[model samples]
Target: MDAGALAAALAAARRRTLSLFDALAAAGYDDPARLPRLSIVNPPLWELGHAAWFAEWFVLREATGSSPGEAGGASLLAQGDALFDSGRVAHAARWTLGLQPEVIKSYCGAVLKAILARLSHAPDDDAALYPYRLALAHEDMHGEALLYTLQTLGAAAPVEEDVADWPAAAGEIAFAGGAFQRGGDQSRGFVFDNEKTAALLTVAPLTIDAGLVSNAAYLRFVQDGGYDDPGHWSGAGRHWLAQQGRQAPRYWRRAGDDWTGIRFGRQVALDPAAPVRHVTLHEAEAWCRWAGRRLPREEEWEFAAHSGHPGFAWGQLWEWTASPFLPYPGFTPDRYREYSAPWFGSRQTLRGASFATAPRLRSPRYRNFFTPERDDIYAGFRSCAL
Candidate 1:
């Protein structure tokens, strides 16, 4: 995109983020006590500051070298590197940081203003636009992170005012899988570094569930003691289960024979037809085993998504696949080096988008990754024929 367009996009993204911060502050989520020291949940105040600091570090400092700092060459925030640099700041230490919401808000505003001013005079070339787009995408990701963080804290779900009704039922879709191109097209727009180097891969014939596994379906696994049955789980999954003492999906509670889940801080009966969510890869794997099915490989999920086959539905929740996160063939890191390289092998791959995902980020080839044990994100699974 050109400089003008990039600036506008950045402005819109900042607005969305600031609005979320406003809501979080109103709900007292900015308080450290409200957000625990979980690896997945960043303190609300720290998250806001980090977003701003990142923008300044990339767009204004690294790209333009005109940002406010020592000799006007470093972060505008004096202690930004110490407090907001995620690479340097430990997850558990975020809670102990003395960050205030109002101060973080000011930092965000100042950083955004500086970026906009720089964009006005910047060239429309790749060098100038890359960091701007990168910052925007990074903030967009953090917006989704904030949503999941809210879910993790049992806070009210974000209001989806623009979301349309999704098709509720779509059975398994069959595919005569063959050689298919995987990853993304960088020329299309701003593609993440991980999605670069798109390559072709051969896939075998498979039938994948059109819709996500539902609460009723997963409940069957729970009733059959899938959690307790060691045969259904991997050794690592069993270890995680024992460590966490998890009985069901996070936020799930049993009342006698029925199940209820906490949605937006309200206890609601499990919707049998609704897609089961907040399940880890381990839990999804166990449910698939109990049901005599298996999670689709990442390639198969991408094929189904691109095929446009009838009864094939997605974008409800981030669907876990039986694939580990890895670099594509000839993979090269983009300008934002830290985005994908560090988490390559340790995280599992999730395909499609969740309801909280930004519409622009929801693409068939867009790959999301998380650790196998993370269940706080809005994640679910669909079964494939074994």
Candidate 2:
């Protein structure tokens, strides 16, 4: 990338980060009393500041040897990578820390302003350019997480009013398995550290779905009593269903055959054409079984996605993958060491970006992970042909 293009990239990234914050503020950032307590959705005010701090630390401080600005920068910005990172910290204690929202906002503005000023003068430097790109992507991911958090809290919905939306999953990609390398090529401008290393793996010729599962399809599972049938569910899935007495997808309420869902603070008719959102892997698995289908393994999912389908519009929705989230062959931790390495073992990977996902945030190689039982997330699933 030339100096002009690099500058444009930085400008665009800053603009996007600001826009995401605008959306969050529009959604709500009033009294802390108004928000839910102990939810993984919103890290406390301090955490938000810390997240911004990280952007500054990696992109500016480490990349360019710059110091964080005044304001709330000193209070929330921690030295090194110890604090503010979810991968390193215990999830539950995030809320216990007292962080004022106003201070957090101030810190965000401070770091943002400082970075913008520095970028205005810094000569064309790829070392500076790369970290800035990474930080922007990191912030974009957090912005999506913030939207998911809102969905969990029943606070708001993240819908892009303009672009045409994704249709439900209709079919699969027929792949003739060969020596397929399964990670990202850093040669493509910028990417997350996790997707950096890739290895060759022989994959079988399999047919994978074109899009994610839809509400109409999930409804069939519900109508057939798929949730009630123990045969369709796995041992853990059945146990989870029994514990919650789950009869329908989370966020859905049924009245007779008619159904309404709480979306974006209001109830709306379920759009059958749109892919079903907020479903767990267990639920997705059961639905697949009932339909005489199966979930695609991670390799299969990536193989299908690598072709770059026009059907995909980043930030529209997250597509669940059958594969467990793990490290690539030569996984090495970058400066943001704990980001992907810590959660590699058990978390299941989800592909695609949701409507809440920012445009530049994700790519085919990006792997998003969560527990199999988490339905509150803005995630959905696709299937493979048996």
lDDT of each: 0.81, 0.68
Can you write out model 1's per-residue Cα lDDT over 306-383, one digit (the tens) per residue?
876767888999999999999988898765667898899999999989887777567898889999988888898999
List the candidate 1 regions with Cα displacement exceeding 4 Å. Answer: 1-5, 63-72, 161-168
**Clash count per candidate:** 1, 9
**Highest-scoring model, TM-score:** 1
TM-score, per-candidate, Cα-based: 0.91, 0.84
Tell me how candidate 1 scores on lDDT. Answer: 0.81
Summarize candidate 2's per-residue lDDT along 209-299 as a digit string, tens digits: 6677878888988998888799999998998998989888888888677877777556777788888878889999999889999988877
lDDT of predicted model 2: 0.68
